[model samples]
Target: MLLQLCLLYVTIWLHSVSAQSSSIAKPGCLERCGTQPVPYPFGVGPGCSMERSFEINCNTSFNPPRAFLSILGGEIMGINPTNVRVNMPNLALSTYGQGARILTVVYGLSTTRYTFSDQNWLTAIGCDDMAAVTGLANRSFSGGCVSYCQSAGDSGGVASCPNDSNGFGLGTGCCRTPIPKGTTNLFVNLTDVHRNWRNNKLFSTSYAFVGEMVTSNFSYRLNDLNNATIFLSDNWSAKNTPPVVLDWKIGQQNCDEARRNLTTYACKANSECVNFDTNIVGYLCNCSKGYQGNPYLDPGCQDSDECADNPCDPNADCTNIPGSFICKCRKSYGGDGMKGGSGCTKLPPSTIINVSIDIDYTWASGKTEISSPSDTRPFISDIV
Candidate 1:
């Protein structure tokens, strides 16, 4: 019966995936729940997924299946299924009946198409206690943040070291540090150095959480260091879906070696095969310019209509070309009004005056002058 139930659940899940995929509509709806808007290259429905790794379940029961990023066993909260957010919970230590102290949490991501923001600000909070936050990325020492406080009264004021101030890290109850980009993992540690934190009785309640640098404000409190709920931000928006950049290659052999197996090399129509840099021997398929979408499949690399979306400047006219777009100035004007480099310049006033017959060139050249054409007969022309 247990096995049957498991199979049933699996079947249901599979059906849900099929339903989601079939529901994809062109320029589909942005996956959103509450205030969070899920970004592109990601979709909520099943067929919308580019790969199985990008699949997400939109649980409708919790007012939008509380966005979660699933891993092997446990799941991290606030991570939008389509977008990934790593959670590094602080390590907590405790003395039998004394309660818990120190909490540590770490987050990691695998190398794939997505790329991380170069820098993230690290924030830390402590009360007469010791705490440190650290991060590592790209096989180098990215950076860290630290916070420490010593006095109960100082818990609410600016933190500074060697003195009893409310602030701990950066001389305040809270301190933040910046991290570099392309970080694949992050680790954090929180500790009680003075052991004096025990005196506050509620000191163990203190805690911390990482978020967009501008989105979090730390309040100094002896009890916050150990409290789980305190670290969760109610207004936090986990909307950043970092881009995953992938470098794909063709067959298993080197470029020179792969060319020998032309029949199976897999370079289709309108595609070119290039040697992979990592092994000089392997090759990869790249669609010709003006073409996009997957290049490995039949009818691959569809033409992208640049003009359909109106990608030109608001005031300019757009011209669609095969696989490309061109911009021109609107009528009534005479300039090559392209965007980006060397835009149109206004015609000289002299040129305008020269083109008008009513204006006298002699007087108009140096001073304000007005003239009437000889062909004008005021009374007869006005009457007619």
Candidate 2:
């Protein structure tokens, strides 16, 4: 019985997946590079992508192969419709002197369909280190954080050092600040806070970089801080560098402006245009409500039959409409008929009746007296 139930669930899931419309690349375009799925608007070669800036290069030199952005020139670690995760280099400051060093990360995404997402945070990791990060993409933005010397066992300050494997930036040996939206070009400056900390062996190397909040992994360890060889090794570099998320859109114009030229508009039939809320001007296409498919392709998004999901009450009838569904009560029933609303109720019988009657009463005052004839009238009924 359990095996049968599991099989039934799998069959239902497969049917549901097959019913949904596809969002794939053009007929002749390459849809994937290595293991990365190069969906429509993003392709592997010429004539594959919607634009030149969306092109991706598949590097086969690696063991399992890797995908990189052709225009921006960064290894593509992960990708979705709205965001792309890339392997960003870290800003390392290695010196004994109590001085500051500046490192600039110029992504040069001004001419591309990409921008920095606000999901990233500017983080600095080291004892006795102060780091500031600035951006110059759509506007001028800056934020900084400071970290003090704190061991894994120390809990002296209000915010203690991260003792767990998952190191959280809490101002002790590590600190992090949020970066503003639409930041492509980044500048980071790392400064050694105290001169006396330079003499200490534990405070050797400092690291700073802009990394996505969810994927970054910079753990706190006293042994890692003391050893310079392990901190600067290739194995450490691969594990320490954080993934940066980049937001991509269809074009550099608003939905209204892009709609003026129908030939160049990205949104097709059965789809709507959504403008970006950032300082940059761009738009994205989405399938209309109750529809699923690629909005950028011909024949556009396909309407989904919501009634197939049995969204209506068991006693109600569900009708599939264009991009929507309607639910109504069955014959001899009334009410909204939806499962969430007042479900179908039985209607009253189609019949009417009326009746009239006369009554008499006697008054008793010392002796029984009969009621007046005019007072004894027929009473009409209200029910029908």
In TM-score terms, which candidate is top? 2
lDDT of 2 by residue, 289-342 (tens): 998778888768988899999888888999999899999998999998888889
Every model's TM-score = 0.49, 0.75
Candidate 2: segments with Cα more than 4 A from true spot: 1-23, 60-65, 95-104, 150-169, 196-201, 215-218, 232-240, 345-384
Which portions of model 1 miss their true places by more than 4 Å? 1-52, 72-83, 86-97, 110-117, 133-136, 140-144, 155-171, 195-202, 208-210, 215-317, 328-333, 339-384
Q: For candidate 1, write residues 1-384 as lDDT tens digits.
A: 999999999999989755443332224554553434443323455654444343444555775454333222222233331235534332333322345544676655443333244334545555543445555445556444445554555645444322222222355455555554545466655555445434443344434444433433433444444454544443221232112222223445765676577676555556666765542233556767876554444444556677777665555677877667787765544454555634445545554344323433343345433555563334333321
Task: Give the best candidate by lDDT.
Answer: 2
For model 1, what is the alpha-carbon lDDT of residue 101? 46
What overall lDDT goes with each candidate model? 0.46, 0.73
For candidate 2, the per-residue lDDT at 382 reads 17
The local lDDT score (0 to 100) that residue 363 gets in candidate 1 is 32
